[model samples]
Target: MSYTSFREPEASPPPSRPGLLRRLARDRRSMAASVAAVVIVVAAAVVYLADAATKPEVSNAANALVDTPPSAAQAEALGASPSASVSASVTPSAAATASAATAPKIPRTGWVPVDNTAWKAQVSAYNALKVDPVPAGVGNLPEFRADCQYSHSLPDDPIVAPGLPGASHMHSFVGNKAVDANTVAEDLTKFTATSCKPVQDHSAYWVPTLYDNATGKPVETTGFRVYYRSHMSNSTGQMPMPNGLRMITGDAKKKKPTPRGATGQFYCAFYGPGDLDGIARSTNGNWPICGGDATLHFMMQFPDCWDGKHLDSPNHKDHVAYGAGNTCPRSHPVKIPAITFDIRYGAKGTPAGYYLSSDKEGKSASSMHGDAFVMWDVDTMNKRTKNCVLQRRTCDNYGYQK
Candidate 1:
């Protein structure tokens, strides 16, 4: 399946031709150092990008596979990370040991691509743990839903589930539910031999809503922020992120405003359909809340697919690939980041200081956190009014229309 093109701001023209390195070197002290650093970084980036461009053949041939695990090298290319902990391989916890008693079952594939070298190793690790396969049975896990989390803001009002007009909606990016936080924590402790260190001040959250796709008019919404604390922290029991989870914001839909104006000015924000705008000025890399606020969520327990494709499951519209080339938000092209990981679960499994802040291994899988996943037809919580809305109407409907 394919996704619609996300409306993007007119990209500024490529940087003006810079003076040659030799010419720049002729300049005085600090400028020379900065230029040399920039050159080195740019060269490294080019090489990584070129290497990541080679798409692996996702296959079930089993025999023609390598034993390499996904690592930051590969993830950096894809613009995403694999899983936390690129070093420090930990032995399977009691949970994995108990579950491993059963034979590993290879997942069936076809719907999406699973060609990355790192992903294959991840699949192997998951199989070793005997985690349940993707339940939908169509293909590997939905690429968009498989990772730790893919952050983005909505461009239109979301559609709410039936019978829950005013119900709170939490994102299942990692498959943790409001009621499953405890279970998630238990499983984390049970899976790793490392002493379980509790993550602090974390909680689950869902700000569902439906507003005008064009006018930004709201139809319905839930208005409160749900905190999450069940996420796993490193063995030192220290929070990896000093500022917590950064606010992710990007308009993946890439929808053009009516009359053909640039909608790229929209920044990323935490709550409200119309909250926040633009990624650069408001993202973790910028001021006015540099790196912004840190928000955490429970990642799904089981491994899914890693092809980075859209999910076309029944009951769901398969928005990612549904309208390729269309103006719809989900039709945007799939941009897989370079994420890194390995089957080695011990202390030496991955690099230090890069993975999830919740784990001992610092190395994390980098995902396309630039865009926001849109949730429509749902009653989203509004902090300003401390109320909610549903389906183009106030969530408190009590009558039928003629």
Candidate 2:
């Protein structure tokens, strides 16, 4: 976690003190030379100070959390004026701001801190009834799996601050042993282990849960399964997720919304995974819901397309992009593995019922948001992505040895 230190060479014996030179019986001209040496040193000091003043502070991009304001299109339907100015501020200091272009370091926290207060509100145009088709031959393909535990007591949610319950919204988490709104890459990677399938991937994954606002009790994803694989047709293999990759989808501000672009899928089960006929329901294509005899199902999909440069973005979702119809674009050519969530929560009510922190009313899925914190063992990701996904082999526990 600590950067290697470089020991400086001993300072040149202080320019050989003039007093010592006197003992050598130096001439008067030699004394003038000594004075000249002192003058040179003073001049050098002045120059160093002036240069330092002009140069920007070495912004330890590690701690920089920058954000810009939302765009006009984002505020169009959100009741805010499109012309509203966004505060492109980086917290921690303001005099010498952190460069928006600098990629932050994520070695310790497994998550890069970000500020999305001003990101362009992703419009409904982002998703036009687009549904990532199910991976048809899951059993025959190599897949990375994570068996995340279901927790009613909040697991550490890395995006939302800890203990300050009503600030943003409520969420449940799985994977990293150490996670919280302020969590960093180190927190997860340095932990003893994780609660997910790839124990080595110590990152946290979370989603907002529906609760009965009246009761103030939380629902559950009692059992969670995360499957990661190549989501592109032409890609032979996938790239490992960079540490500190933070992303969000779905609008947490829309009082009533539907699932469009974000990986917000809900349905009912009838003895199988993809059986959604009479039971599948959603509000205007926003939040989908399915209620059955046993439980309610939630499925989410992350973009397999990546820009290949950033681990985190100002808005969190900008760095990575979604593939078009399961084919990655040249712009986001690197095919990082895509993950799908198969979540089930116990239910006892009608199909149209669920709760979100954004709107206690739970009437609209518009306020829903899903946060993802990505971190993993470099070796593990490389092996699985190359061997299972690229090779088109179905595997459990990686399906092959390194």
Candidate 3:
């Protein structure tokens, strides 16, 4: 009777399932948002600390990087992909590190020495081809006497000056030798200028157009550009010039004359290697001529070619001597033909002076001319140059006179 009146208990409503997005959104405040905020703050703090820690380290390490190029370890560390920690570590330093990595470095070539033997050979070859055979071992002559002076009139003057009284100012060194340029410069300071004193320091024997390994004939290097000025006496206090070097006027119209009144007057002197005889000893004294070390005095003057003497002399190789073909005290300015200084070392075509190349054109409108080795600055003839007869000793010194 009771069962008949009993009704089924109402079924519990099926549990409602929450959606994934809804569950995540509902959990965002408790688990995700708060955790994410804390995580962000901690990450920023780590980055700040890392930045602070690495700045001084990077600053100190930057100079070291310059001195010693990056090592494998440093490079690998830089290339590693960034994680949270890595990003914190590298972000502040990335710019500095990139700069350090890419900063310009002195090329290996800068520290390395160049072999000048090729140039030396070129000079020798040129001499061998000349009508007159250049003498052997030309630069081995003994030192000039302390007071010895070169003759300006005669073709050869024994212009040998002694090293300084206490210490030799002139150092006897050759190409790329182990001699301190500064010490040699100091010695040059003690050099007292006489009429015969050369205008250059630290002569390195050379001859133009020499062939390979031939050593055909050596020439006494007459001039060079030194790093410091050794002669304060010669300077007019107007402006400082290269050390142990003198500036002389080459071409007046093309170049300004020497401010200190120096002229293009230069004499030619020849020297040969010394033997056991006293003639060619290392002693500071004049070298005698006629087999006494083969010293000869010559001037840079140009004699008339038709005079039947010194007529065939050429300036360099295959080039007409300076002022050649130009008459003296003549009706008009003499036009001198220009030749290229070097086909291999210089630009194509005949140079500015004389016209004598396949690329030769008419003469330049200006009387002044230049070759690869010599340039005339037409600003004024009064301007001075490092040397009167340029040898183009340095890279900067190359090009027609200027």
Candidate 4:
């Protein structure tokens, strides 16, 4: 399988690392294009086809996918093998965006709606432990980096709205090409060019594409990177990501900086060191544009603990919970690998900010929502990730035959 290394077509060399202030004011734009997501073993590419504005009614047959979250039985089934699909019975709803008069604090914990409250005490204990992953943006650490550009828009969201069509907000997929609403854990094991490095990790990762509500057009997600090796690298023991492990962080309903979703966050990236400045929002947490050499960046950390019994939760995210002070909660005592996404977009300034697919502002990143639908072959994960992340090796170029 061939993976596409991130580089713009005949693009200028990456600009020299500029000042944080300059980067914040005029962060450079990435060389981007449209694509179509296809599962090709060779480069297993996602062909670019920027259709964020298209909203094609490919089929009017009441899409069983992209329609709603899962039911109790359905969640239980998928926890085993992400092959089940959400029914068209449920509808998606986010709280209305608050007025823009003030920027609210990001909530302490994420806005997790739970069907099983059993983890509450665990969460409290977990929170009480105060063992959080090393704080983000600690650029001083020896960070592992693997950069790859995006292939295209994936209207097929296999994780959130699987097996059915149009049941999910469109996503920008990477790694596996065959992933659609119907993709399963078995499908991920087959060889394919993944967008992630160390190619061996044929795991798929994606987020809702950002859109400019002003123009109703898609914003270039460009290519992003995978960062590993944090300050806690040596202390934490890791395990492979179980198949069908699904999670969602951040609220799509928040248009501004509201603590309603704290575990999920939205902040800015300056080229230099300074406190992350707050951006204006539209009630649903849509950030205003950067005024300096700043760029918009998103960070999402997955739960480090698992219950060892369930793979998914009825609420789609309540099954796995965050570790307390870096240690897995007793309820979720099984310590798996901790995954965090540090995504930076090449954009700057306030006139036209961003929104995501399900944003309340109509196809904007304004009400940015993030979802992670993972499917990895347990065996492949044992080596591709467990060995490297657990052993504290900053590995890249995955899948290259030894």
Give the whole-model CA lDDT for all candidates, comma-separated: 0.22, 0.52, 0.21, 0.47
Ranking by TM-score: 2, 4, 1, 3
lDDT (tens digit, per residue) of candidate 1 on 1-402? 111222334434335635654444354455645654554444434332322222223224322222232343223323333221113333543433333344222211112122245433433332243212222222211111111221222322112221122232232222122212112222322332211111221212222222222243332211121211111111111011111011222222232221111222212233434223222222122111112341211111111112233221111222121111211121222221111110111111111111221111211222112212211111111110011110111112111111
| Best-performing candidate as measured by lDDT | 2
lDDT for model 1, on a 0 to 1 scale? Answer: 0.22
Q: Cα RMSDs of all predictions?
A: 24.8, 16.9, 30.6, 22.4
| lDDT tens digits by residue: candidate 2, 1-402 | 111223334433345587765644455456656654554444434332322211111213322221321123223322222221223332322211222123222122112222222211221222122322234455556566767885333533445443233444567777775665446656666773677765776767787767744466677777778777666554442444555566676666666454434434345555755435324444344344443454556667777765444455445565566766555454344556787777777754344455675576645555656677777675565556655665655655544422
Task: Please give, for residues 1-402, the per-residue lDDT of candidate 3 as tens digits.
Answer: 001111334433335744754655565546645544444444444433442211111122211212221234322322322211112323433333433344322111001111134323322343233122223332321111111121111111001111112231222222212122222223323432322112222221111211111222222222322221111112111111112211111121332221111232111132545421222211112111123323322112211101111101112111111221122111111111121111111111111112111112222111122111111121111111212111111111221221
TM-score of each: 0.20, 0.58, 0.16, 0.55
Worst 10-residue lDDT window, candidate 1? 235-244
Stretches of model 4 off by over 4 angstroms after superposition: 1-146, 227-237, 253-265, 278-286, 362-367, 375-380, 383-388, 391-402
Model 4 has how many clashing residue pairs?
61
Q: Which digits, one per residue and each the tens of the lDDT, describe model 4 over residues 238-298?
A: 4445554666665655554433134344466777763353444443444544445667677
Error of 1 at 321 (Å): 6.7
C-alpha lDDT of residue 235 in model 3: 17
Best by TM-score: 2
Candidate 3 residue 134 C-alpha distance from true site, Å? 44
Off by over 4 Å in 1: 1-38, 44-48, 51-402
User: Which has the better TM-score: candidate 1, or candidate 3?
Assistant: 1
